[model samples]
Target chain A: MSLPHAILTALLEKPSSGLELTRRFDRSIGYFWSATHQQIYRELGKLEQAGHIRALPAPTPARGQKKEYEVLPAGRAELTEWVARSEDPKPLRSALLLRMRAAAVVGAPGMREELRRHLDLHRRQLEEYRAIEVRDFPPARRESEPDRLRHLVLRGGIDLERFWVEWLTQALGELER
Target chain B: MSLPHAILTALLEKPSSGLELTRRFDRSIGYFWSATHQQIYRELGKLEQAGHIRALPAPTPARGQKKEYEVLPAGRAELTEWVARSEDPKPLRSALLLRMRAAAVVGAPGMREELRRHLDLHRRQLEEYRAIEVRDFPPARRESEPDRLRHLVLRGGIDLERFWVEWLTQALGELER
Candidate 1:
């Protein structure tokens, strides 16, 4: 449900071909809302049919040609309406924590190794987010409304990865003791 | 997927009727993984059919009878295997962050109110976590492995609420500027 609206928002920011949207999702939108390329393409078709979005004329007519898309006025209105609606916060589903709970019951054999694996993964992701932060939102940069908002989203990712690294370390320490 | 495993974990901790399981989920399991009462009943039926769980014979039988469930040895083995498997950490999907992004483009009318509401909600949750920490996890008490694991999960909730409160405060400050 949110995915369609997310796509609409992205297209409103910039008209993009399906391929371009897929790449953008991997780099940006994927940070918060991940979608496989197939899912994105399928949603694009739905949005086009629903009158929320429209495909630009193909430069070359072909069966498998990529098509560009832009949000219609309806899409913008829908996004605006959706923005104003209040949504309840849902608790994030964490597989690691669930495993921890299960490990407590079944005995945490081999779990220490998995916890360490998670630690390494989070560390790499933390570095990746930090590199992005340094590259994109350097000091002295004039921030626009959209830029500031995007930076906040990036901050969410950075903070979350840091939390994981910290918590996983604590877990490992506890497991070893 | 994880829901069944979570149910298994809870059942292993204590055998409970379906209705009891629903209430437990709203309090404890609900912290990390949430499920509606209907989903719980449906999964209970499936789990029974799959031989992972079995319904305990009731002393009295009648319409709308409450059914108790217990995990079988097969269920315990399955949960143990699941606990040891490596799982990829999912990207945290946040509707609030999505709303913030949409607000940046669509104009955030009335969004300040929502942000303030989130702040208060998180504040209350943070306090509740702290209270639990003080009451149950008092440092004077010696801890067992299960106790420590539960505490770690509690810490996850506490840390996450703290993060939200901090981030929301920062976000509100930015909005006011």
Candidate 2:
């Protein structure tokens, strides 16, 4: 459900071919709402068929060739409505947390290493996010409304990674004790 | 995949009827990894067929009647192996964050209220988790290994809720400005 809207959002930001969309997803939008390249391509077709988007005029629109897409009025209206729509926060579903609980019953001796591994991963992610912040959002620069909102989203990612790094460290300590 | 293992963990903690398992999931396990009663029941049947679990002796044992289940040795072995397995953490996929990013493009006028609503929800959830912490993990109590691991899981839930609360409040502030 959100994937279509995610695609619509990315398209509204800028017209892009499917390949460009996939690449952007891997870099930016996917940080929060991930979609595989296949899913993105599939959704692009559905959006086009639904008249929410259209392929830009190209020299040759042949099969298997890249086709650029831009959001139509319908797509923009739908996305705007979705922004105001009420949706409940989905329940947390972490397989790692579930595994930790399962280990409680089974007494997993190997989970210590697993927790360590997760710690390393979160640390790396947090570092990458911090780097982006320093590069893109240095202080003393006036930001537009969109820039402010986008920076806030990046902050969310940084904070979430920090949470995991701290929690996993605590979990590993619990295991050691 | 994790649902079956979650069922096995619950059964190993205490043999229970399908009805009872569903209730427990709603109360505790569902907080982290939620499943509908229908899915729980379906998995119960599959686990039984797979010989990972078995029904306990009951007087009636009729169809549609309650059937108690306990994990078998094979199930325990499987769960133990699963606990030792390494799995990467799944990427975050949050609709609210996506909505925020979308709103940045479309200029959602109504998103201010939406952020407020989420802030309230996260606040309530955080309070609920804190209440559970007070009731279950008293400071003076000496916890066993299993209890420690279980407490860690609960802490994960609490910290996550807190993260949302903080982030949503910040988002609202940004919108206000």
Candidate 3:
């Protein structure tokens, strides 16, 4: 449900060929709503068939040329409706946490190392988000309404990673004790 | 994979009939790794077939009598191995955040109300976690090793809910501006 809206948003930001959309997902939108290239391509076809988007005319019209797609008015309307829809926050589902609880019953010899590995991963992710903030949303820049919302989304990623980093550190300390 | 392991851990805590197991899942394990009653029952059957767990013999064999299950040595061994297994942290997949990003592209007239609603929900969840912390893991209790590990798991839930409360509050503030 969210993937189609995610694709529509990306298309609205900038019309792109399927390959370009996949690249953008790998870079930006994927941070929040991840989709594989195959999923993206399949969704692209669905959106086209739904008349939510259309392939733009290629200047050269060459065979095997990449087809760029732009969101139709219907797509924008649907995205707007989706944005305002009321949905419950999804419950937490973490295998690591579940494993930790399982370790309480069965002694986990390598569990500490696993926690350390996750701590490192989250720390690196936090640093990456911080770098993006510095590069893209410096305090000096006057942001538009959309920029503000986009920055808020990035902050969500940054804060979530930070939470994991801190929690893992605390868990490691408890394990060591 | 995790569901089966989750069931093993719960059974190890205490041998229980399927009905009791479902209740426990709804109260405690559901916080992290949620499963429907049907899924829990299905997994229980599979575990019994796998010989990782067995139903205790009833004093009187009666039709529709409840069957209690306990983890066998093999199940304990499997759970031990699983706890020590290396698993990558699952990447975050938040539909709410994705919707916010979509809102950035399309004018979201009711988006602020949605953010506020989420903020309220998260705040309530955080409070619930805190109440559980006070009731279950008081400071003066001299916890056993298993208790310590269990408390750590509870802390993970508490911290995670706290993260959502703070992040959602921040998001709502941004939306206000």
* B1-177 per-residue lDDT for model 2 (tens digits): 899999999999999988898999988888889888899999999999999999998999799888899999999999999999999998999999999899889986999888888899999989998999899888654378888888899999999999999999888888888
Per-residue lDDT of candidate 3, residues A106-169 (tens digit)? 8757998999999999999899999999998987652687888888889889988988988898
Instruction: Pick the lDDT winner.
Output: 2
lDDT of candidate 2 at residue A84, scale 0 to 100: 93
| TM-score versus the correct structure, for each prediction | 0.95, 0.97, 0.94
Best by DockQ: 2
Ranking by lDDT: 2, 3, 1
For model 1, residues B1-177, the per-residue Cα lDDT tens digits are: 799999999999999988899899887877888888898999999999999999898888776998889999999999999999988888767888878877777877877889899899999988988898898888754279988988898898899888888888887877776
Compared with the true structure, all predictions reach lDDT values of 0.86, 0.91, 0.88
For residues A15-49, could you state the per-residue lDDT of candidate 2 as single tens digits?
99998999999889999998888999899999999
Candidate 1 wrongly placed segments (more than 4 Å): none
**Model 3, C-alpha of B121: deviation from truth (Å):** 1.5
Model 2 C-alpha lDDT versus the unseen true structure: 0.91
lDDT of 3 at A126: 92
Task: Please report the interface RMSD of model 3 to 1 decimal.
Answer: 1.0
What is the DockQ of the complex in model 1?
Answer: 0.72
- Candidate 2: list runs displaced more than 4 Å: A140-142
DockQ-derived CAPRI band for the predicted complex in model 3: medium
User: How does model 1 score by TM-score?
Assistant: 0.95
